[model samples]
Target chain A: MNIVEKILARASGKSKVSPDDVVFANVDKVMMHDVSGPGVIKVFDKLQKQGISVDKLWDSTKVWVAEDHFVPSAEKVSAENIVKLSNFTKRYGIEKHFKYGMGQYGICHTISHEEAMVMPGDVYVGGDSHTNTTGALGAFACGLGHTDVAYVLLNGKIWFKVPETFYFKLNGKLPDHVMAKDFILKIIGDIGTDGGAYRTMQFGGSGIDEMSVQSRLTMCNMTTEAGAKNGIVEPDQKVFDYLTRRGATNLNLIKGDSDAEYEKIFEYEGSELEPVVAKPFSPENISVVREAPSVELDKCYIGSCTGAKYEDLEAAAKILKGRKVKIRTEILPAAISIYQRAMENGLLKIFLDAGVTVGPPTCGACCGAHMGVLAKDEICISTTNRNFPGRMGHIESQTYLSSPLVAAASAVTGKITDPRDLK
Target chain B: MDSFKNVTSIVTPLDKVNVDTDQIVPKQFLKLIQKSGFGKFLFFDWRYDENENKKPDFVLNDSKYDGSKILVTGDNFGCGSSREHAVWALLDYGFSVIIAPSFADIFFSNCFKNGILPISLDEKTVEKLQQETRPIEVDLEKQTIKTLSEEISFEIDPHKKKILLEGLDDIAQTLQYEDEITEFEKNSKIPSVL
Candidate 1:
């Protein structure tokens, strides 16, 4: 069995579990965000009216609530929703709830990764699809719906049909300036958005072993756009070391069986890969940065759970050094800790010196919630995932998804230019 | 969630592929927390121009697709983000049936929970459905789709089918194992990160 299967089998208390078998496995943790919070509580209220009263969450300790979408109150309604979520957390004694203006909160995905709340062999679920980001920690994490999350709150378990695994085997070493964002964009291009629908994408190979935990997180983070239920890397010393640093005393690493079966396998030579970008309207529509079409941008955004990591921000800052951006540029750290680290390391100063605006650690510009909303016919080169129409603003506004290296270069040039073309 | 047994209506064919959740319900409109009141904002970007006026050439704005209950779209529909608001927006816009060659996994699962029938027909059949200008009929119990010219059979998971047919939400289904969950919670590892 693979790591996903082993985790499900253990959670379900089954000796063995195979693909397509329905099982209600014990949920290790259920996460929800401000955007999805009211929906969960709405369903919870309906369930309570049905006489299924839950004074406390089924397991108060096993729940995580975050407020990032509408920080500092985007509007009256969103503020009200935050209040409702705060009240729910208070009533249920959900101690993990992190509201805005609170300490050390970034996007829910990055925060969960930084906190190491998810462990290997655990089955985790969150209301947001990007919850699969935690799978980098070697957990079977996936996304569920509002009512499904509400059900997980009432019961510590949720049903799943064991997903077939698709092995993404990477070989060779990645070139400098090429990051996991380029690797994943290339993958999404090869296998279009629906490629892994209802399946698990188990990333493997010596290349994965050598990659940083940050790169692994970015790799698993975008698997949701490919329609994968979960995207995971086998637990390695890197993950263990990271978790240990975050104060995990007893670590039980989970790995797939040596001879585990896979539904299909895709092998790539990482050395042959170059920086790639997903053109507007679809993450699947990708092109190598050098070969991209002639286009300019109204802005360049370098933030989000997928892009605003310490390494990612550092890469962007190095490129932006001694150069002023031709257009608007935003650099957001993934968390307060990451923000403080960049500030201490002078990476934030590099960005600030480059005429870039450094912002708070929120999903701020990524979701087009408030800051960085593109206007009509505007275009942006961003280090965020998803280039869908109207994702960052007006339907006519376009966004090209690229690595931080490309985003910084594009920012300096005010166009979709290649980082490799820089002097 | 509402119970769904049957739906019959004229089809609205959207020809574009990879119609993502962002286009279904844009991020800006997601501020409205309530599930309802999203009908007016369905495809808000496409349905309206920059001036907030209705676009004349949009599919949903066409006179032919007025009051359309069934939508036939290209492959890989609902392909980004897990915003359930996308599903709510579609349901609120009075769409009971969506016929596609394929759907994003999360969005497909979301359709079932929201009392909407997402029927997956092969690309050939979906293309055929797009050409028809007559009423389309869907029967969940029979798992059959009837059109002006042909009848097509569909398959759904037994659990999902039962829940949809009986109008049982996740809470209702899990309530059956309430005692089991309570016991499991009592025995499992308590979260330490909090």
Candidate 2:
């Protein structure tokens, strides 16, 4: 059996399994956020109308609620919803609720990992699609609908159709300007976005050993762009080292058998990869920025759940140490905790000395609610996910998605240019 | 609901992949949950210029796709963040059927709840559909889509098919299961606080 099969076997208490089989697996963890929590609670209310109490069904330790987007900026309706959800959390005695103004909290996807709610081999589900980001830590994580999340909230069990696995074997070393985001964009461009629907993507090969934990997280975070359910990189020394640094012990390390069967396999050499960027509106519409003339940015932002790791910060700081941002730029560390760690290590000072305004560690500008909104006719180069026009607040504004290094260099130049070219 | 033994509609073609929720309806529009009047904001960024003037380069501005009730798009039609407003905006804009090579799981499921039919076809079939400039005939009752050169039949879950055939939303469908759900809930164990 494959890794996914093994995880599902343990989850379902079954000895063996295969792809395409439907199984009811016990959920290890269930997460929700402000946007989806209210809808789920409403469904729970309907279930409660029939006298169904969920107190006995769920594991209190495994449930988490995060108020990330629109935290301080929450609209009246969503704010009321957050209040109702907080009431539910209080009634249920859930201990791991992060509210607005809480230090070390940002987007649910990024903050959950920082808070150590995820563990290797854990079967996790969140009410947001990008919950797959947790897969980078070797967990079986995916997204579900509000109804399904509500059902899990009520019963602590959810159904799944096991999917086949696709192995991506990486080789060679990535260039200075090329990073994990470019690799993912290139893969999506080659596969045309839907190539891995309902499949598990497993990253391996010598190149996996070369990538830092932060880069691997960025790689797995965008598997959703390929329409994949989840993405996993086999645990290695780097992973263990990073987890140990984060104070994670007692991790369950699981790997695929040497001869594990996979539905398909893809191979790419990192040395051949260039700095790629996803054009507006589609991750599949990718081009190497150095080659594409239409690719220009008016603003540059570097920081998000996908690009906010310590290593990511260090890389940006190294590039911007003696440089001034020609374009207005904002660099948000993933969490206030991460920012504190960077400050302790002087990474924040390097960023600040280089003229980068470090915003609060909230999911500002990523979801278009606030922070780094663009002006009309302006464009931004962002490391966050989704580059749809107006995604960063201005409807007429265009967003170009790229890696942190590219964004930093673009900030220094006030236009979309290659990081290596700045040197 | 209006009744029809047979219904057919023409579709517009926009051959771009990964049409995310933000593109369908900007996050700013999410502030209002009234679930109506979002048609004008569908594809808000791509359809409009800096001054809020319509960009003639957008497919929606093309006269040929005017009043099109169906949308034919590229593969992975809905990706990125899961915002149900994407489905709501599309439905409010008068698009009932969306044909693509594939769709994101969350967006695909959301479309069914909003009484929109999201059809997934093979790449070859999608290309063939894209080549046809004229509006194609789509018959929900027959589960068949007809073009100038070919007729394609697709399969749907029995319950989902019933809902689409009757134009019923999720709330309406759940009311049918209310009796069984209530019985199960009544006999369930009470939850305990940790």
Candidate 3:
């Protein structure tokens, strides 16, 4: 069995499992944010009406919460949701509630790693689709809906059909100008939006070994765009060292057997990949940065769980250090910890010197919830996932998804510019 | 939860592909606490203009689909966020069934949990279903969709079929196996990462 299969089999108390086997695997960790937290609360209310116990979780220690999506409370409704979440957490005694303005709060996916909320060989689930981001640590992480998450909260287990694995092997290190965001975009373009639907996308080979832990996170984060069940990398020393730094201990790394099977194997030469962008309305529509359509981009957003990691910010700062942005730009770090790192490392000063606005760590415009959303007919170059209609505000507004380097370079010139092409 | 059975209704055709969750129920309306009353917000951007007036060009606004309980659309429906609000909005909007060539994983599961039956058919068959102007009958027990021209069969997991047919509460059903779950917890190598 492969890693995902082994994890599911172990959690389900089965000796062996294969693709298409339905198992109610025990959940090691579960998460819900401001958006899904309130949604789950609603589910709990409905379940209580049916006489099922909603008084406590199966294990409060296994459950964590985040105040992303609509934090800094954009308005009354969102503020009320936050209060409701606080009351819910207080009543339930969930100690790991990461509240906004209370230190350590950030996007749920970011907090998953920055705080080491998920560990290797664990089955982690969150209410947000980007929960797959934590799979970089070798956990079997996947997203669930409010009803499903609510069920997990009450039962500590949920059913999943073991997904067939699609292995992505990258040869050699990526070019300096290219990043994991670019490679994942190219993969998504090749496989269309529904390419990996109901399956797992696993990364490996020399290029993955050369990549940083955060870069691996970026790759797994966007697997949702391709409709994947989860994205993962085998946990190695890099994962162990990274997690250990974040205070993780007793790490039990999980890997597939020597003869483990993959439904398909797709290989890529890392040196050949160029910075790419996914055009508006769909994440599968891709164009290399140099050949991208020339549009008068109105904003350049460098934020989201998909982007805005510490390394992502360093990549952006590398381009913005001595330049000024020609267009409106914002660089919101994904987590407060990343924000502090950016400050300590002078990335924030470099961004401010480049005439960019750095906002607090909130999901904000990434989910089209608040802070800096686009206006009607506006075009944006964003280092965020999902460019669907009205995703970042007005339905008419257009978004071009790119790597942090491309977005930063574009901010300097007000057009989609390759990092190497920047003057 | 209502046990889903059969529905005979005019099919609402959304001709676009990748009908994402954000488009289903725009982000602004997600803050609302309740699951019901979201029907009005379903496809908000497409159905309404900036001033909140109904857009005449969008399909949902057409009087022909006013009472549609079934929606037929392009491939990769509900492809973005894992927000169940999208399914809630669809269910609240009275859509008991959705037919497409494919669906994103999370949104597909969200549909069944909320008593909404999502059907996946071939693209050509879905395109045919989309163009049907008359009401079509969807019988869940038989797993067949009856149109004027032919009867189309669909595949659904028997466990999921049982959930929708019996309106089984997922949590309640799991509680019946409490002993097994407790046994697993006692014997499993459960890690305390936190």
Candidate 4:
């Protein structure tokens, strides 16, 4: 069995498992944010009305909460939702709630790794689709809906039809100008949006071994865009060191067997990869940076769990250090920890010096929720995943998805400029 | 949750692929804590103009799909986000059955939990159903969708079918296996984490 297969098999108490086999896997950790937190609370309410027990969770310690998506309170309603989330957490005795404005609050996926909430060999599930991001840590991480999360809260387990694995092998190191974002976008482009549906996308090879844990995270984060159930890389020394620095201890790494099976294998030469962007309306609608549509960009947003990591910010700062942005650009870190690191390392100052507004960490405009969404007919280059119609703002507003480097370079020129093409 | 009743209605057709949850219920409306009122916000951008006037060109505004209990759309419906609110909005708007060529994995699981029956059929069958102007009958007991001209059979997991048929609360149903779950936990060796 592969890493995902072995993890799921162990969690479910199965001696062996195969793709499409249904197993009720015991969950190690679960997460819900303000948006899904309230939704799960509502599910609990409905369950109570149905005469089911909603008194306590199976294990409160395994459950964590985050306040993102509409944090800093998008409005009175969102404010009330935050209050509801707080009350529910207090009532349930969930101690790991990352409260907004209190400290260390940010996107749920970011907090998962930053706070070391999940570890390798754990079956982690969250209410948001991008929960797949944490799979980069070698955990069998997947996203669930509010009701499913509500179920996990009470049952500590949920049924899953094990997914077939798609092994992605990268040979050689990525070019300096190309980042994980470009490679994932290229994969999504080659395989349509539903190509990975009900399957796992696993990364491995010389390139993955050479990549940083943060870069591997960026790779897994966008697996949601391809409709994958989860994304993973086998745990290794780099993963152990990354987690150990983040306070994780007693780590037990999980790896695939020598005879592990994959449904398919796809290989890419990292040295031949180039910066790419996903055009408007679909993540699979991708084009190389040099061949991208030449349009005036209204905004450049460098934020979201997909981007805005410390390394992502460093990449952007390197591009923006001695250059001024020609458009309205925002650099919102994915977490307060990342925010502080960027601040301490002078990445924030470089962004501010480059005529960019350094904002607080939040899901923000990535989901079209507050904090500088695009207006009608506006165009943007974003480091966030997804560019579907109305994804970032008005129905007609367009977004071109690119790496932080490309977004920073585009910010400098107010056009879709590749970092290599930047003046 | 309501038990699955054979639905009979004029099928609403959304001739678009990858109809994401964001469009089904946009981010702005997600602030509402209650799930009941989302019917008004379903397809907020497509169903209405900026000033909140109805857009005549959208399929929902054509009056043909009024009170539609079944929505037949292009492939990969409900493709983005794991929001259950999308299913809530669809159900609140009176949709009980959604027929598509494919659906995003999370959204597909969400439908059964919410008592919405999402059926996957071949593209040609879905397109043929989409073009059917007459009211269609979807019978879960028989596992068949009957239009005026043709009857199409669909497949579903027996367990999922039983859930929709019985309107069983998922949490309550799972609790019945508490002994099994506890035994699994006791016997399993879980790795330690930070």
Candidate 5:
């Protein structure tokens, strides 16, 4: 059996399970952001009115909430929603609430990783789409709607029809300057946006063993763009060590059977890849840098749960050390701890000295809630996931998705320039 | 959730593929905490200009397609972002059904939960369905879409079909399995270790 099947089988107390099996699985952890929390709270109230008053979260210790999207509330109604989350958290004795102020917590996905709230073989669900991002740690995680989240809170269980598995076998090491973002972008290009819908994408091959946990996280984060139910990699020593560093005691790992069945398999020769980017309005609209259109930009954003780790910053800082950004640029560390670490390493000073605005670690401009909203006919090259129309701001505005390395380099030139071209 | 039986309504055709949630209801309009009143904000960025006036050229704003309760869209509709607001906005805007060749997994699942029916057919069938401006009939009991030209059939998950036909939300249905879930939780054991 695949790891996802193994985990679900155990959680549902079934001796065996396969694809298309309907089961009530026990969820390990659940996360939600301010943007989606108010609706979920309303659902809870509605359920209560229906005579199912959820007096307390089934497991407050296993639940988490973070106010990242619409942080600093762009509108009064937005702030009122956060107030609702605050009132609910306080009343329910939920201790994991991360409010908008009180030291920004960035994206909920980033903080969940920073907190190490989930362990391998865990079945996790969140209210936001990118919850699949956490599966890099070897958990079976996926997104759910507000009512489903309310259900999870009420019962600590969620129902799922086990998704068929699709394997992405990354073979060799990524060539120099071509990183995980580029690699995943290329794959999404191959398999159009809906190619992986309703399926689990599991990573394997020798190349994964050599990649860092951060790189693996970067790879799995964008599976949402491919319409995957979840994306995951097997945990290794690097994962265990990172767990130990982050104060996690769960070191036990899970793996798939040597000959697990996958509905389909796709292989990639990673060493032959080029730095890639998704063109405007579609994450599946991919182009390698050398062949990319002459796209110019008004703003470049290098942040989000997708690519905001310490090393992602280091890669960006290396390109912008003494260079100045020609366009408006924002460098957001994904979490406060990452921001503090980057500051200690002087990456913040390097970016600030190089004409970059180091903003607070909210979802900032990614969701277009505020901060870096674009104007009519504006163009932005962002490291954040998803490049749908009007994703960052105006419907007329354009957004290009790329790696942080590419984002930093493009900021220096005000176009979608490759990082290798920078001095 | 209302019991879904049959519908005969004019279709609003959104031909663009990968019609994401952001395009369905952009983030700016998501500020409203309450889900109601989103009909005004549905496709807020595309339906209205920067001056807050309606754009006549847009399909939804066209008088010819007014009172459309069914949306026939291109492939991969509602692709990005998991906001259920997108579904609510469509429902509030008086669209009770959507037909596309394919849909993003979450959005398709979400429609069943919200009492909206999402029908998936082949590319040619969808193209044919969108060509006519006439009202089409969709019968949930017979599982067929009837137009002047032809009658097309599509498959749905049996479990989801049961819920939708009964006008049941997932919670109401899952509550029926309360004992099984409780029993599983009580006897659960970690599977990480060999």
Candidate 6:
């Protein structure tokens, strides 16, 4: 049994269990954003129709609500939804409501980690599928639908069929242009999108040892692409050191037992992996464009919960130090705090010097609602999740998903070109 | 909401894999909190053209899929994002069941709460069913899905099974315990009454 199995077993009050075995487990935390919160509130209203009070449901202390996407730009309906959520929070006195433009906030996933909403050995659920982001901290966190979130809000527990474990072992060092996103995209392409459905991915091996904590976070962020509930890297000194630096303490170190069983194991030599990209339509529809092509980019976006880390910014800055963006490029830091840190560290200067427009740290162009909305036939190279057509603005707009380095290089070249080619 | 027990409908096949939540219901439409009226937005990006016009090329836009109540799709359907809008949009679009070889975890659970039955069958059966364009009779009462050529029986969790059979959402189902809950509340308030 692995630590996830052990924690799940203890939480479910079971001796032991394997993948595909359905178990009712206690939820440690539930988080929702404004977009999903409103729907959950609607369900709450329906639940209360039969005379059930919202207070009698889930523990308020364990649930959190944050307004990130479309923040400050709350349209009529969304504004009303926010008001309704505010009322619910005030009525319940939940302490974790992150109002727009307040305290160490940006995207929900980044804010959750910044505020330490995730802890090791906890089963956390969020309304967005990217909730798998918290698995970087060694917790079993995954996304759920609004109704399921509503159910957890009412019951503080949910049922899950324990998924099989898939071990992704990486050896060798990643190339300069290659990072975690490329690795994950390559893995998804190899395994096919559905390969890891209803499964947990455990990343390990020497290549993982070479990855920074930020890099590990990027890798864990895309576990959803593999259709995985969560992705875990065994807690090592690097993890402990990173968490400690982030002011995290009293952390429980979790790992698989010596004899733990895995449904599938894949070994990869990271040194051999080059920059990869997932073209439109599907993440599994991947191709390795070793030599950056000359496909002109209409826009270049270099930020998201995945690619807005300080390291990601620094890497992009290094590439764009003296170059101006050829395309209309937007650089959004993950959070206000991260933005402030970049400014303090002079990374923002590098971006400004390189002619990149810096925007406030909302979801920005990631969800394609505001900021860098694309026009028909326009193509963008973004460091966000998913490259499905029309994902980032225009219905006919094409999005190419890649790493920050790839995005920065493409911004400078005005086309989808490899960073190594620019160098 | 109408009870869906024993209702039979012709199945429309959506053969694409990894039908994500975003595709099911675009984020733009998520601004509305209400569950209804999202049927039109279902597969918004896929069903529409660049001019926001309906793309005649899309399967859902085809005349054959009109009034499609049962959607049979490819494996690992609903692969991306956990937006409940996917289920809401499907239900709003008049789909009562989504039969596929496999479903994304979050989407699978969402279906149960929204009165949409997401039935996972063997790959062979899914392929076999995908070939049939004619309406397949899905008898919820008999717990069997039958086409002119083949019939297959499947099982759902007893709890979800009952919920679907009764057309009860999670809230409605939980409300059944109102009496016991109120009594327990009263007893807890006055322990001496025990």
> Rank order by TM-score, top first?
4, 3, 5, 1, 6, 2
What DockQ do you compute for every candidate structure?
0.50, 0.28, 0.60, 0.60, 0.66, 0.39
lDDT of each: 0.86, 0.77, 0.92, 0.92, 0.85, 0.81
Residue-level error in angstroms, candidate 2, position B157: 4.5
Report the TM-score of chain B alone for all candidates: 0.90, 0.87, 0.92, 0.93, 0.92, 0.87
Clashing pairs in 2: A55-B191, A55-B192, A56-B191, A56-B192
- Candidate 5 structure, TM-score to reference: 0.97
Name the runs in model 3 displaced over 4 angstroms: B176-194
Candidate 5 per-residue C-alpha lDDT over A169-231 given as tens digits, one digit per residue, 9 for 90 to 100: 988888768878998888889988988898998887878888888888888888888889999
Number of the predicted model whose lDDT against the real structure is largest: 3
Candidate 4's residue-wise lDDT over B59-162, tens digit each?
88887678889899988999998888999999888899999999999999999988999999999999998899889899999999998888889999999999
Fnat for model 6? 0.61
Model 1: residue A397 alpha-carbon error in angstroms: 0.9
lDDT of 2 at B15: 80
Would candidate 6 be rated incorrect, acceptable, medium or high by CAPRI criteria?
Answer: acceptable
Q: On a 0 to 100 scale, what is the lDDT of residue A238 in model 2?
A: 71
Give the residue spans of candidate 6 off by over 4 A.
A291-293, B1-3, B49-53, B122-124, B127-133, B170-194
lDDT of 6 by residue, A1-423 (tens): 875676576556667778878876778899998888888888887767756676665689998988777776646776777788788888887888988666666788887676677777778989988898878777788898898898888877777888788999999879888989899989998988778778898788899988887788888888888888787777677777776777878877777678988988999988789888778767787878564345777888988888888788888898889888888888988877789889999989899988889987777678776777778889888888887656777767888888899888889888777888895
Candidate 3 residue lDDT tens string, A1-423: 888988888888777889999987889999999999999999999888878778879899999999999889999999999999999899999999998888889999999999999988899999999999999999999999999999999888889899999999999999999999999999999999999999999999999999999999999999999999999999999999998998989898888899999999999999999999999989999999989999999999999999999999999999999999999999999999999999999999999999999999989998888878999999999999999988998899999999999999999999999999988
Top candidate by DockQ: 5
Worst 10 residues of 1 chain A by lDDT: A97-106
Candidate 4 residue A6 Cα shift, in angstroms, is: 0.4
TM-score of 1: 0.96
Restricting to chain A, the TM-score for each candidate equals: 0.98, 0.94, 0.99, 0.99, 0.98, 0.96
Considering only the true interface residues, what is the Cα RMSD of candidate 4 after superposition? 2.8
**Candidate 1 residue lDDT tens string, A1-423:** 888888888888776789999987889888998888888887776767778786767798999988877776777887888888898898888888876677777789888878778887779999998999889999999998787787788778888999999999999768887999999989989988988888999898978888999999999999998889999999889999998888776777888888888999999998899998999888999999888988877999999999999999989988999999999999888788799899999998898899999988778767888767888899999999988887787777899999999999999998787787887
Distance from true position, residue A413, model 3, in Å? Answer: 0.9
